[model samples]
Target: MTESRCGYIAIVGRPNVGKSTLLNHILGQKISITSRKPQTTRHRVLGIKTRDQIQAIYVDTPGLHRGQKRAINRYMNRAATTSLRDVDVIAFVIEAGRWTEEDAWVLEQLKNYQCPVLLVINKVDKLEDKAELLPFIAARNSEHNYAQVVPVSALRADNLTALEQTLDAYLPEGPHFFDEEQITDRSMRFLTAEIVREKITRQLGDELPYAMTVEIEQYKLERGVTHISAAIYVERDGQKKILIGKGGSRLKSIGREARLDIEKLIDGKVMLNLWVKIKSGWSDDERALRSLGYDDE
Candidate 1:
């Protein structure tokens, strides 16, 4: 009989580099949220995948970014960096043709760890010339002693099978850490809040400030329908006006989109009510950050 294999794989990269997208596709589910905006992921999400005897627990982290201006920014950085502890394999993800200072910074951070680093070049689909992939991979590979370098388009699920196979090979021999049927370590309430935040991020795009966050005010089953009330917090009254929109149309639209996704998530009917509130200086306040569920621990 094959021995059970299980270990942690931390997917780390700069903002908007498809770290969350890769994890979601790897697990064949949407546990970690994504958006065009940078730093859409604010927390470290665990996505567990069990196949036969191999169970891979993937840590999908927020983008490791520079300039921790706000308390929230600092919190995101801590969340991303702390995920590296005791991990078996580190997937150092980056864009296909673009390498910025932030990418270099993240790479530098990996040098301190002893685990094998896999240089995953994501978004290769966007590269007009596929031939440039080899040279780009070669250039990145030379920068570090990577265990392996794999190019993939996480968005299209391209070459992900090979990536998974590579990760499976690196997993250390051990008993399974979680149940074979389990998919993620995150709770449903946390995921629901993340879904709402994702919809708002996708809807508002650049118009939405980084100060926004979602808190589940209430969640319960009543008459076979899941009742959820979430508060969308912003830092200023003007931002509140922007989120609520004219005649509450924008807020309603956000609620409608969020409710549909939440229903799909729970596989049940949902009554989602969203309210925009202003809480001045919440983002920069450490105590407020903890209360908003941004706790680093």
Candidate 2:
């Protein structure tokens, strides 16, 4: 009989490189939220994929970026950095044709690591000239000795089977850390909050997305329906007004979409209540961050 194999694979990358999208597709579920905006992911999310005897626990980290202007940014950076500890494989994800200074910074952090680093070039489908891919891969290969190099489009779910096979080979032999049915390490409340946050980020413009967060103040199951009360917190009144929108139309839209997603996640009826609250400078306050469930590593 084959021995059970399980290991943690850290999916590291710069902001908006589709690390979360890659993880969601690999696990065949939407555990990590995604949006077009940079820094949409603020915490380290774990996605587990078990096949036969091999279990791959993927650590979907917040994008490692250079801008640490806010206290929350520092926390996000720390969360992503700490995910590198004691992992069997590192999947360094990046865009197909674009490389930035922040990407270089992420690579610099991986320089001293002892584990194998698999270079996953994501978003290859967006490359107007497919011919440019090989050269780009060749150039990046010369920079680091990757265990394996694979080009894929995480959004399109292209070439993911090959990526999985590459990751499966690197998993160390060990018993599974979690049950087979479990796909993530986060709680339902956390996921619901993230869903709400994703909706807000998608609806709002560039500046306000990063200035706000979602908190689930109540989650209870009664009879057949789940009642959820979530607070949308922003740093200022103007931001709150923007989130709520005119006549509460925008907030209703966000709530409607979030409720649908949450219901699908739980497979039950949902009564979601959303409210916009102003907590001045909450994004930059370490104490406020901790209270809003940002303390966990």
Candidate 3:
């Protein structure tokens, strides 16, 4: 008998539910960039988890949100919803502190799936008393008939081992979707963009997080230095000015911080050039969206 187990699992939830954080924690690497804002992830990212006997082919989908008025925003929402097509299991992440219409809406979105679903109650560390958890757990059980209700805190790494154990029990036996040593499916260019995007989300406040996208236009490996150029796209001229800052100090800081991480990522000194452009509502513009690689209409 073949003893190996592997299957594709989709992570779906509303904004700020810690989906990316959990993926990074499980893989023991930063495959996805995370921040305090919602809608930080603009596309679906694949993170592969392999052990001797089991491998979890995890798909980290974007947080569900109102579809973008433009073509690009449409792609982002589709990236989250489209993963349900051929998955073996679905992991719906939720903040345990409260159950809202949005939570119920996310569960209702899964009514179309025949695959087993796990209700993952994240942010458990925020609760100190066991009694504080009783209602949250019950609320989830009442809202959906989940294959398993696993409580975990992505920030604190709580109950994640139990999650893996439970996932093992329900997954169908199959060959690994990726090779044993594989960890992520994103390219170096995509990762470089993501790294820049993460810093942008942290530095820029408000809707800037959703309005921004990064692209690596050039990456050149030179002697003792990796020369790179990336474009930061925003929707308005005000954003461009804010990002560039007075005397261009703000943009310089973002570049410096992202360059440091890029140096570590490529294991070489980096010479990075950052450019900020206004796309005149790129998130809502289909043509601009397509150019940005989210063009799937």
Candidate 4:
């Protein structure tokens, strides 16, 4: 048998550009949480894509932008930029609906790279027609000169096979980087945190979701119910008040939804108890970021 081709593919894009959605769709599982809000992703989440002769280890980086004045933000920004290097193939995902200066920033930086990159123009469903793709593609390619421009509607599952085919050719031949059956590189605890975080991102408004962090404090399986307790940390008491709501109704709702999602993700019954607390500038703290796995160094 011929050796399988294995390589790392980094999907880089600006915030809310559907990077996580693309990863989940490609994995055929919801390994990552996606939202319409900016900066919904904060870490580099790796999702594995395997076929008969290829294993694509994909790293989905946090959306690139000028970060908040905090260590964690810096750490996140660094992680996004760091993954750009040392990859066999790069996928530059664009929203296709909006082209911001940030997009230009990414394309400009990538233009200097010696490696091949596939420009993934995501969200084609938002477009009107194929003829409309020219200017958008031209604008980007005119600047950076991508290896190949492949349009894909990741949310709608359009042209993924073509995207995969391009990747298949670009990646180098080697032994598989991960087991063919594996989907993601994150732990259950990490996904649990992300599951809760995703719910928060969808339910809450303003900057509450970004300022918060979820930690699974206890997880015990008893009989049919996986009893779980999680702590949602915020930097201020006012934010905690909003999270718990009056009579703890909001917290209860969040718990029920998160529990249901956990049950689905783990394929087991779950009894989740969620509690919120103030961490006092947790996002800005280097220690807090490190503890949450956003290590800058």
The Cα RMSD of model 1 versus the native structure comes to 0.8
TM-score of each: 0.98, 0.98, 0.94, 0.95
lDDT, residue 211, candidate 4: 85
lDDT of 3 by residue, 1-297 (tens): 558998888999988899999999988988799988877887889999998889888889988766456666568778888887888899999987777777777788888889999989899887777687878788678867899899999988888899878876766887777889889988888889999999889988574857788888998887877888999988788889989999999999999999998888778898999999877777776677778877442
Model 4 scores what on Cα lDDT?
A: 0.84
Candidate 2, residues 46-163: lDDT per residue as tens digits?
9999899999999999998888999999999999989998899999999999988888889999987899999999999999999999899998999988888999999889999999
Error of 4 at 268 (Å): 0.7
**Top candidate by lDDT:** 2
Lowest summed lDDT across 10 adjacent residues in model 3 is found at: 65-74
lDDT of 1 by residue, 70-102 (tens): 898999999988899889999999999999999
lDDT of each: 0.92, 0.92, 0.84, 0.84
TM-score of 4: 0.95
After superposition, which runs of candidate 4 have C-alpha atoms over 4 Å from their true positions?
207-209
Residue 37 of model 1 has an lDDT of 94
